[model samples]
Target: MKHILLIPENEKPTLTAAIINTLLVSVLLIALFWISLNQIQMTLDFSFIGTYRIRLIKGFGMTVALGLIGFIISFFIGLLSALGQSCKILAVRYFCNLYVMLIRGTPLIMQIYLFFYILGTAWGIENRFVAGILILSLFEGAYIAEILRAGIQALDPEQMEAARAVGFTRKQTVRFVLLPQLIVLTVPSLTGQFASIIKDSSLLSMIAVIELTQTIREITATNFKLFEGYLFLGFLYLCLTLPITLLSKRLERRFRHEA
Candidate 1:
């Protein structure tokens, strides 16, 4: 008699199994959290949520607006910076390289202080909301630049050679051959970066940007419900980020399948 395997290799889990696992893990986490809270003799009170509902809604809107606007501006900045890095001109290449290095090396909080206090003061950027958006864009742009640069560099050299052999001009080659593939390759990563933008926008609260975090901070300050306020804050952020995270994974799988 031949030995038989019980399951197929690399088989995907059934929907029912996935659902069951999800519920089990969720229940385990909730139980552990409840037990920990009981040990600490602390109970969470979300009663303040109803009172501060309007402010929370406004703050949530501001955060979403900031993230959307920042991502758009930063994407263009990143694209140009990525292209500049590969340019033949030494000055452009060095400038782009230095930008990526400085931004990535330093903490964003420091940059925020430097830009808002010094640069914004000098330039007369009096509006804190505008200043925050610019700061977030510049900070995130460096990271996006590196992502795009990696995507560009990862493209197969043979494709370029093939384009040239087919008498495709540089512009034609880029537009027809390179741009489409680069977009496809980098999109999943870029989507994930948008989620990062949402989380990082919280840091803008330090500058009094009046986004979700700042709103929660102000509420907790008055009500002294720090635990409840922050717990709700985490839930609100999950509402924003979790969907993007799932979409990023789905895109990665779909693209990988296509390839």
Candidate 2:
């Protein structure tokens, strides 16, 4: 007797439901916005966008720059720290573990303040941009270290053994085999972390770093347009993060396909 096989059907996306949800969300947002504005004695005023366009543009540029620089620095730190944690040497592993623990356990804002007030002063670096970038890099490095470590460790053990059996040096094996796969695995996560870094750049504003939030504050301080200023701030953050978020998803799909 022959057996019959059944395959599960894929669920089709419903555009009608999607459209209805989008419309519902739009209506709710509009109603909430109107109510909030009324409570705050504010009306929609997009005039600030035109008036401070150049300033806002500069602020956005600065914020992007901060995130990019910090991410780059953190990437290297994370890679090295991951390598350290994976090293056979117990001292190296312990030190790396301690570093990761110290950074991950603390609040990022506290780290930023400590860097600005304590380390920056000790280093005689009065530049807020440099301080902000350094602090963020340090803060993000711990998380990225764990991400990379997990990716490296999650790789099949046979790959490493095969490389060693072929008389490949550890360094050569990591460079030629491990790193390529690790990078593919970690790309989505790294991109998402970068997006978070962009958002966290707002915290630098508390220290008077002239990023997007700071720019909004400066504009609102003079104009008293709190509602308009904050709305634009949220919009600007979405602009910065949405592209990277989408890119991460795309990269994840591509990696999965390749795998």
Q: Which number leads on TM-score?
A: 1
Q: 1-259 in candidate 1: lDDT tens per residue?
A: 1112122468766666667767978999999999998999998899999999999999999999999999999998899999999999999999999998999999999999999999999999989999999999999999999989989988888988999999999999999889877877898999999999999999999889999999999999999999889989999999999999999999888888543
Candidate 1 lDDT (Cα, 0 to 1): 0.92
The ten-residue window of minimal lDDT in model 1 covers 1-10
Candidate 1 Cα deviation (angstroms), residue 55: 0.9
RMSD of each: 3.4, 5.6
Compared with the true structure, model 2 gives a TM-score of 0.88
**TM-scores for all predictions:** 0.91, 0.88
lDDT of 2 by residue, 1-259 (tens): 1111222357543666556667878999999988987897776888879989999999999998999999999998998999999789999999999999999999888998888998899999899998888888888999999999989777878988999999999899989888778878899999999999999889999889999899999999999988779988999899989999999999998998654
Give all candidates' CA lDDT scores. Answer: 0.92, 0.88
Off by over 4 Å in 1: 1-9, 164-170
